[model samples]
Target chain A: MQEELFTSGRNIPNIDPYLDVWHWPIALYLFLGGLAAGILFFAALFYILGKDEVYPGAVKKATVIPPIALSVGLLALIYDLTHPLYAWQLYTTFRIESPMSWGAWVLLIVTPIAFLWTFSYYREAFGGIESKLKLFNKLKFLNTFEAWVIKNRMNMAYALIPLSLILGVYTGILLSAFNARPLWNNAILGPLFLVSGLSTGAAAIIIMSKSMKEKHLFGKIDLGLIIVELALIAHMIMGYYAGSQVQLEAVELLVGGEFTLIFFGVVVLLGLLLPAFLEVGEIMGIKIPVIIPALLVIIGGLVFRFVMVEAGQLTRYLY
Target chain B: MRYAMVIDTKKCVGCSDCVVACQTENNVPEGFCRDWITEVVSGSYPNLELELRSERCNHCEEAPCVRCCPTGASHVVEGGIVLVNASECIGCGACIASCPYDARFQHPDGHVDKCTFCHHRLKKGQLPACVSVCPTKCMYFGDLDDPNSEVSQLLKDRKYKTLAPEAGTKPHVFYLI
Candidate 1:
């Protein structure tokens, strides 16, 4: 036996120290990015699908807000990095195999497209002469030349949907890659993140539109989207409970373990349930302000990230 | 070549001599460790058997930490030892998140840190600090490719195992139960 290779010796004592120094900034970044991605993707979907009738002024307003929110989200992501200056390296040195590498590329691609789409809307708001310049005029295509660009670029944008879905889902898949920590290791994490991204994105757009007082033509569509979000969340929770015993124990950590209260009370109830109830109320002829549910849903989305990121880290790998 | 460490749990006495030796040799930061041990006690108190495992970067052939690093700061060296360039590390903690074994830590200088299998010592034809100071001689280090090397011989002769073989990391570190 290989055990014969060594002579006997004394044992060492163990120390299990908690390393919880990081907070806020990391959590904030995850929340902001999820919101930004969610909002931008939804807006693009509405514009491409010609679903304007379902949510009148929503696409226009949504197109304007996502770029700014995305810029803020990008800043938050850079801020959370240990070395923010090296962020440029993500663009310069790209690796197709790594998800971080892929995310960096996706951000690079999405950021400019989002900005151009947003700028197209303000070309008229900001004045016309400047909009005539080649660059500005090209950007104005999204608003003025929508038919030509969409006819030519529609396939390109359609290609972006799957890519965008990958970008949204990559965040959760990143966490699940750590197989040692049973809590984060699940095949379902990818879909869960994708759904959550859509939910958070819709919530962000709803909140922004209400705040700006842009005509809430999209209220019914927003309500419909939120209802879909609720269904996805329910599926995720049920899957979390019925999966592997080891994973179920890990889920217990979120449902009632160390993170139980926050996960159930803040994320599940306030974040998801309250927002869901508000949407239902709107559908049933009650006028619960849309902002109230939007805020709650956004908070819930942030809390979901907090719980997943922290809880995944907290669980130990027992071999 | 894939460099690896074979640990015989039966021979380990749970003494932390390897831990301290590794720290001093590497000049690891305060309150942070590149290598440590975990003890899992099973069964009732009266019949409990203490299992001790020394943990460190597995120097996986398909290392996830290196893949996750945004700056190319964390990477696998020539010998398959996963090394981090402290100067380049932004301490983004992404590598820390990627490691399945939880073998990484953030240094005070705001860089990701972990065991490098004592790269400097290896270059000088010496054993790693942990392997050199292991009092019970529980740790064995060598090139996995060389059939005559101590590690390869051990693999050939013993029914050894590795942590999370299902992870497909092809970790260089192995255990002899």
Candidate 2:
């Protein structure tokens, strides 16, 4: 009765004692991917609605986050792959049910669009680049492509709306598809990641925008997205709470166990609630630095993915 | 025709002959195995129940690993044996995360690797390496579709349970308690 000890026979390195198949790289990839999706989404959405002038940050400024974020995110994904050189195999066939397949195809088609959309506005963003370098004028296609893109930019906006939504949600569905992991086994994860992406996207705009109206508008947008994300998180936790015994154990990782402090404190309190309250205060005439709330939301979004990926991998059906 | 395994947990001594046989037969690589043993001690010490069984890929009927595989790499073949086409696997670890069995590993050659139910042996009309090498004769493998098969008879007669039954993976591995 004093003590009891049990020896583990399930000893397989990298699998047996503790499952460590996915790590921080996967988490980082997911966060950056969602962020890029969000940035592309709002940028395209406002352009489609003819609010390009009213929300120049969404269309031109924050649009810059996509190309940079996508490149880094994709690199993280490639870095995680044990068969990094074989990544091109993903494009050979499309498994409609596979979220990774969807991710591959979507990124392939949308990544170029994100760059092209940004390039279309390069002249506006860097008005005198051609004059300063004198080499830009030699690439006549660049000017012709810019003019063509500028004309059909609305069509690109139309395409990005659906594609961005898929990319944003794809990050979450990627985890949820692993029904073997009880923590990531909920459908709510899709919308949760999507809303978090929107919030993070809006935060990017708020960080980069110089206009007071654009900053204020995005603060409100991030605030709204954070609310939706919190609600989704609640629904997800509640689903787990009311779900099977395995799912209860999955939620326990957040509520009463290893993930409690970070999930509630960092992701919820600091990432979502603190930033949310700050945004509300700003609306109520309390002046706050835009960087403060924006950075908090971005950091929260990043940590949320880490929590989900790390904790989800730890939750298994066999335990 | 579904091929399956039936292990008599009550007779298993946890000697790990199955683990070695699998490694040698399939060339499963160092520090890795296609099958292994698990021991559980439950209840008070005096009345404790000890259960030992060899475990491997369940070759699930509703295999999530196959479903989640992006490049059609992890797939089910004849007799419901799940196999990974190493060349096609991007090693995204989706199938790894999706498997309730924890049966797969990233091979050193940079591809997904797992138990193929001794597919090469089966093709030659031989028993799976682990089943044939079990010292206790506690392990049995055959086509469950045939009523005369030892696995079918044992499962029909013995009180057996599968691992993670709640997962609804429809696991083909059975442990006769």
Candidate 3:
């Protein structure tokens, strides 16, 4: 065995092996937020480029998910905060350097836009369906608001594109900004999270959409994102491999250490690669059930966040 | 007036006087501490060297904890001492993760807490409780800006090192090995 040293500060909360300051709630929140960002980015991109005509499911129908996802995500975020009552202080001032500050503001802006985008498709999405809830059907202000949103939908698209990109990248940067965790100290995490989010968003559309054409289209899109995700993961691992002693130990935690099985066996193998191959088979007309690959992709996205957040905490500069 | 700390590792016997002294003086809660001892062993089995360090906040000149606080809770005051504004902190733990030294801790009261270098004691021209009670008198505290200060003199005369120097944090705590 190599040289071993021990300490007496075993009762401390977030030191060494006990380092779990951020937990499953933060992981789940990041996953849902990234997924929401992915859905919004694509929904906006398809509309601005006039591809909404060809991909109505991706453009309009998928917009329904973000508002709900964002609300749930925010609840989880609030639940995770130790001093959640003080969270309002995030809005009183703005610091350009703080990623959390950037995230707080971006989420505040995007959640409303996500609702507005979905509402613009109100007549098209929920027109003929009869509802027992007479209150929703009777709101005169809602009808006027919907009309206004429809008219401004194009302008909203311009704002959504950049905001969604920042939201997606912000989830990853939130972790990367913590230079103390050697595993999350890489720059590629931003692009990696963005691509992973898009893949999961595409999967959500494929599962939710009834049209065979929409399912096939998103399958192909997800395949491309999976490729990019794999490349980024490889590049990030290489960067860690080539880094200093601390980084080497950090990578070892993923490669052959405690996280090897869950990160590789579950996230990389089950979450990413398996779903990607299943999608490819679907694209080749192998008649795979639409839900299997798509659901796998979604599960993969959630597990990916768990792996990153947990593993990053296990890594540190000192022993 | 940049305050700095210098602890002579050779003279330290790992007695943990600093830990107990800081706790009582600061009224730190049970199962929590502002500073603790760390024992590091490096090199292979046959050629090993052990070092004991009484570690606490680095009080970095380029503090990431100050930068990452969503609210202006964690800030650097005069003398390059990084401190948390307990009333303002959201206890989001971003500053906790940002620290390379793992110095900051969330108090049971829902705000972050760490070694303040006894800022209150210093205000009365008194030494920090830990430094005052150290049996070996190995711990030194003074303004690094003044060339005549003990911390400045010890750093000049001896070969010393700071923890996690690669972080670019420019830590004020020095270890005279």
Model 2: residue B71 alpha-carbon error in angstroms:
0.6
Cα displacement (angstroms), candidate 1, residue A116, comes to 2.2
Tens-place lDDT per residue, model 2, B4-75, is: 999998899988888888888888778777777777777786887878878889999999899889999998
**DockQ of model 3, rounded to 2 decimals:** 0.64
lDDT of 2: 0.88
TM-score of each: 0.82, 0.96, 0.96
Error of 1 at B81 (Å): 1.7
* Backbone steric clashes in candidate 2, count: 0
Worst 10 residues of 2 chain A by lDDT: A1-10
lDDT of 1: 0.69
Ten contiguous residues with the weakest lDDT in model 1 chain A:
A1-10
Best by lDDT: 2
Name the better of 1 and 3 by DockQ: 3
TM-score of chain B of 2: 0.98
lDDT of 3 by residue, B1-177 (tens): 999989998888888889999999999988888888888777877888888888899889999999999988888888888888887888888998998988888888888999999999999999999999999998999999999998988999999999999988899999999
Which ten contiguous residues of candidate 3 chain A have the minimum total lDDT? A1-10
Q: Candidate 1, A204: how far from true, in Å?
A: 3.8
Error of 2 at A200 (Å): 0.3
List clashing residue pairs in candidate 2. Answer: none
Top model number, TM-score: 2
